[model samples]
Target: MTAGNRCRRNVLALTVPIVAVVVVVFGFALDRWVIDSGIEIAPEPAALFPSAPIMDPARQSDLDGAHFDALFAQGIAGLRAGKPGQAAAAFEAARRLGPKVPALYVNLGFARLALGQVDAAVESFETSINLRPAQANAYFGLAEAREQQGDMEAALGAMRTFVHLASEDDRFRRRALSAIWEWEAALGRRPSNGTDAAQTETNEYAQAKGSDLLTAELGRLDGGSGTLAHFRGKTLVLNVWATWCAPCRVELPSLQRLSEKLNPEQYAVVGLSTDEDPDFVREFLREVGVAYPNYLDPGRDVAFGILKIESYPQTLLIRPDGSIAQRIVGARAWDEPEMVANIESVR
Candidate 1:
């Protein structure tokens, strides 16, 4: 999907408005339309300031598009009415329905920004980028979040990417360029390895795929037999976990939610538990209402021996053709937009 961006102005363009918005999602109303995606940005070294303005390049393609959802509209309405809390909730509810629009996360970021939730705003913007890396406006919001965290290099790099990807005719292109220039002057370079932020983002979570293994028979929690071969035609989200691992327990519900959100015909999320006690696993699943098919490996042969998995709560993304695509070694918000889209994007 082609991503779109919308921002009434840049962060440093107006000191009063930008600061107000970041502190509180901006004004109760800015002129006529809602400053739907405003953030508090400070240009000075003392604070995280907005550099310049970058307007929305694809206004029509946002939540108001042809495939509109009521929740998405409600979120926009909340933003427009100066009620960011309501706006944030609406956006998340809309996310559960799995709307693929990148702007959705953009608006959610603004709402979080207004609430003074800098970390969450950063997550939303990054997720938007994950959905569509070319979405120029997401960079605008991200620059602010990175600045707030005192990551000047990352912030500068995000603006640079925005400028590179944004169309020349984009009304706010000049303003964004101005921000970049100011950031570079202040930092004394084009972001001393700022691009590494994006690189490390992927590097931390993404692992290289390897060859398919044993395809061996395994014990199902229901007493029937199973194997990786049964899911050959679908992308398998193989989560290696155990009932005893606390992080695994924390990650399972969201993984189950991820399983539910994905198209069952094309994707399957299965649990590979290494618990010696099948009844304990059964009790854990039943207690959590986890209905996904799970296979047991008491001896750890299939896990440690075959997959070479050395950690608990590990996840592997298996392609439909029986090859591994990606692996994650820790807990994650499996149901988040980035993770869901990552799963669906598997070839």
Candidate 2:
């Protein structure tokens, strides 16, 4: 070979490895960013009871007719208005009228917890459980109240019962299991065989059976309006988050990076903010530098009423055909190769 050609070939060989090394180092840094984002594994707040007024025929027969119904309606209204004190009073009156109804006591307990009456909340939950031993929601309320009171043992016990009594397909079952694992670790006890085994083998992404996406028009954080249908014909990583949730904040950067990396034609990462204040949500999105398409569900019509999502920072991977492909609870390293591969699998 000519001397000039040999010199050029050596230079090309040296430059290729240098460029490869830089690319490898950059990839490692990105992976570490995803891992070190402080994604928390703590359990989210349990969904409150009596999402609406409780007026079942069986329960109404036990009450003083319209009097109990009026009180129950008042309590539900109070809960919706964020007036837990008012809700507690109304529910207490309803409880007096229909002491035999377990749901009344459960709703009363939910309101009491909101008012920081932890001891009373425990009593109320226990009463509901006693009246109806299979009341899964009562156990969930008791677990949350006990945890708030710094009683990990009682919390763990209540949560375990909740997991056992709850349906296998119950959305809260997995969250409760995650809590059980955390509590066991906190108490320095080995996780029970069932829970530990499940945790170890748990896939980060759970295949969802049905479509839960809502087509309700939601206000965009930036401006104007949009509906979930706007993203039709694309694989969506729908992240349900709230501004106050620490884990949600921690994982947002990774989610933003993932949104940037994915092909916009095939995959879309969208955020649904459950925050009630649009201004606050807009400010938070700006602070976090999240550029993904996000919409606000201020009244939670979609998050709670339609989707029945009980926790914050929950992510749903939706297929192009609109079927829910996966339900991922808790914060995750979305930019990681494993997560990217999982998203790719569905696409």
Candidate 3:
């Protein structure tokens, strides 16, 4: 070959590989940017619990039979698909097949609620609670139905019962607590000293004398690390949430708006996702348009162990000294003027 041709060939070979590398790198970068920018990732079959309560097999042996089981399964499927009418029919059938099962009534109540039949829903929930007085989920359903009927006093009463009966680690505990606060506020009365006196007293917020928050480190979504100590000098509004929690999703936008309204120099809004899958957490954050810094708590070390937080969307306002100033148990309109002022008062 001629020397000029040989030189041209060598240059072409080197240039071709360099160009290919650049193209590949750019493609990957773009893909990442799209993902981070809230492009919906095909989520894993969502690890979701049915809103329709399930039959407790331990209590009702009749429900263990195939006929009742089949009807119950159909009811749950209908509820999940948003076919409340179908769900109610199925749950009613299940109840007929196993009249002793309180959960059947609870499921029926949820279906009724979905259909906006508040009175029927209330009856169903009341029946469930009467059949099994300690049924926690029934109380939750009853509380919701009462609220729908504009009975704040009854709603608060049922909610308090749910909070009292539910286990300390129940996921619904915090949301129920938040609901109690709203119901009390609406009625222009403080929570009455009753069976849930301690919870009522601390309904608005919980105080922790000392916390080990600063010692914990978590993995950030952008392939980095974060710790509570990083915002040592600023008031930290730390939120613990999960992808599957409905109340958490409802509250996230407000938290984002709150973050925007507050001065970043004086405050920091951080989210800790308790989802086991980091990919799901990232996709959820993107889908929700949450721009605040988020970290993963795959093992729930910080949420359950350090913070002793059991409910989803539990937010803590940490004072500059690393002590927890307030623990908000449920979702709220964080961007509202009053909420903003309350947060500012903490600072």
Candidate 4:
């Protein structure tokens, strides 16, 4: 398949990024959004990154945003203090625990930018923009990243786009304008076609494309193997989660109930766990009394590698054509009336 034809997860919450000085003052980082530092980051794999012992999602997710807030706040503090490593770790943890928040990526991008991780910052900001277009912060960060890369044309495009899209009350509008003026002159010095490339990429949000699932391999709960193609012609509510995730566990019951409410002929609510311990996932599901059909992506070969998913408790609504209808990051009360209507709307 061609590059345009692939869509594993767009799972890329495809999340977004960042705090930046709109004036493009390369050395002097200023603004309320620029983070301060202090938290120490661990060098372990993302799944094993260390944190204070979690209080259990039972006491967490149901409350909606406490654990996430604390962690995100920690990341902000770390960034404010200029500790990008610490901030990156905290934000990475937040993406796992919190909703796949776009701004979180922006903050992450800001830290990366400060750390001079220009390429990574671009990816972070682009991911944020993918998750949410028309976001001033992500565009601002993108412009900053482009400028740092010496792509003056791209930088001007992003900044001008930012100026155009920013809301009237946006705090960064003044700074964006200042950056645009500076970049335009810089672009005048040497003309380049970088803007079109940047805009082309910007137009394609991760969610804007359809995903192909016919080739996706999955392991069934009962020692069976299958492909997502098996469920063609029905709307698939595919939930990507992990047993280690508090929010995933907290959201399971509702998902199970939602599955019960769905029509077999028209809809299917499926669980895809990214747990390495399949036995543990099976036992956990059984203990939780969840009856929805579940599958595994042991070692996250499919979840992280193919899908490029970064957050847990993310759900994607796949149309009969296998195109993703909606991608919701974070946990939600799946059986709520509003939720039922939302799912039904996809019908």
Candidate 5:
């Protein structure tokens, strides 16, 4: 071919390919854009965060106080709905968005406490109180945690603060007073009689008097071959629980670890699950990574009465002869050195 013809042919070849490629790319882009436009974008993960500070349906559109108020209210609603884990997640997100709001931390603490993250709840409440000294709910939450840990004095102190700060909230005020009086009377009676003291310790009060657990023979689940009588002549850690109780869930793993570490010759750990639904209890155990042998309480309240358990997550340290050595209730950081010492002391 001549030079001009050759040049023209080469330009056509390059231009034609370039134009085809651009048209193809544009068509693909258009198709993607159309599809994306029809699809709704998913909500932000943290968009569900509580915003109670500035909450007013009429005013939520504004970035002002009403928006955050709505978030906070949403979190509170979550709590009322029995969705504590969701409430906590909401409160935590709200806290990040509005760092100065002490109420968010207090709410977060409540949610965490309900979820059995006791230490985290304590920390959140402490932070709330530090930020706003007048936040009475935080103090109440701290008191709850202290009570769970069996620290009557500290629990009382926290309750007193709650009463002092939230006198305006009549409900809280009445509750705090009742708790204080009950704890005081219980404390007075704890040290006087060993048996009564042991009973007191069955709930959270057992942390105070340092009492022992009484070994009571009880019926077995599924009509098992063994009986409470079989556990005789052995030191035992008997923990009462229910799948529905969050604190019970947290205490389960700790009890398991305690059991695995101790020699049966020296000590035994027994789990009594108070779930009326055996299947639910078994499923919960499997889901929660618990390996401890669990006995079902046919008449849940019967076991409670026999164990003198005043609360969920009640743990008893029993002597070889089936007498109580110590009783504790609620979720405690069992791995703590002090708790370890307490458990070891009974042996």
Candidate 6:
């Protein structure tokens, strides 16, 4: 072939490949935008309770929308008035009118709990969770029911899962985490490993789905000073721990080491204790020696409000932007390379 012909053929080959690539990219983008569908499962509820039995929700024809709305509103009013039985009846009537709606199941669960129908509440919450596992509130309800039945382990597990599923809101997350920690301590099975494998899974899911962490704020412990805003512009590593927690005892040293290693220009670590007794916290700190600033949260004021911290030794890696970067539900090897890498990624 002539040299000019050879050059033209080469240009054509490159152009064809580029065109094919563009077409493929465009197709994928279009599919992504068009194929997005309505979510079937509502995000897990912030509350969870154990499974139980109660009267079935009533079934009504689809045409009864107005009736359903009225019943649902009345049910909510009943719930607000601390009449779970009345609320359940209202929600059941609404459900009978609109059998497909899952929020009514959640409402029913709340009403059942108020009536002390532990098993029934669990069933309602589970139905809600199954219908919408992403709903943190359902999970929270299920956990609450389990707690009522004295099923500490399951309740604790569900509570942890709640926070893991919803840690973006400082309020709910703090409350959930504190509840989890409190229960775990109460059961004497606090996990201190701070395992990254499980945490990585949760973080990936939250990031991909844009789920919020629990962000409710508990009241201040003993009127402790400083809001979470005080830690703004700095990476805050907050650990919710208790003196009696085995895992807390195991993880304290590593946390101290990590705090010491952090450059104050970027990071800070604080340990909030739920020891119930400030003296226990003070004595433990004095004996074992925590280098980071430690505060007492015996009543879980901070744990309940800002982070919804559910369990002891729960570590939160808060970014300078004041958002949670990583949340380790149990104790962790703070000095591990992977932990440092993950924390740094958010930084």
Which regions of candidate 3 fall more than 4 Å away from where they truly are?
A: 1-211
Local distance difference test values of all predictions, in order: 0.76, 0.82, 0.82, 0.76, 0.71, 0.73
Write down the TM-score of every candidate: 0.39, 0.42, 0.40, 0.40, 0.38, 0.40
Residue 153 shift from truth in candidate 1, angstroms = 69
For model 2, the stretches where C-alpha displacement exceeds 4 angstroms are 1-214
Tens-place lDDT per residue, model 3, 230-336, is 78888889999987788999999999999999999999899998765566688888888999988987556568757889787899998888888999999888999
Each prediction's number of clashing residue pairs: 14, 0, 0, 18, 30, 91
**Cα miss at 1, model 3 (Å)?**
99
Total residue pair clashes for candidate 6: 91
Kindly list the per-residue Cα lDDT of model 2 for residues 1-347, writing each as its tens digit: 99999999999989989999999998899887755757667775876466787565564444475898799999989988999999999998887887776777888999999999999999999999987676777898999999999999999989887765554456787888888888888887865554583344332212121233545657787656678887888999999999878999999999999999899999999999976557778888889899898898754656664566899889999898777889999999999999999998995
Using alpha carbons, what is the TM-score of model 1?
0.39
| Worst-scoring 10-residue span by lDDT in model 3 | 202-211
Q: 116-224, model 6: which lDDT tens digit per residue?
A: 8989999998897776554567778888999999998888778767766564553566666667767866776556775433345556745743432223332244444
Candidate 3, residue 31: lDDT: 85
Q: Report the number of backbone clashes for model 4.
A: 18
In terms of lDDT, model 6 sits at: 0.73
lDDT of 1 at 267: 91
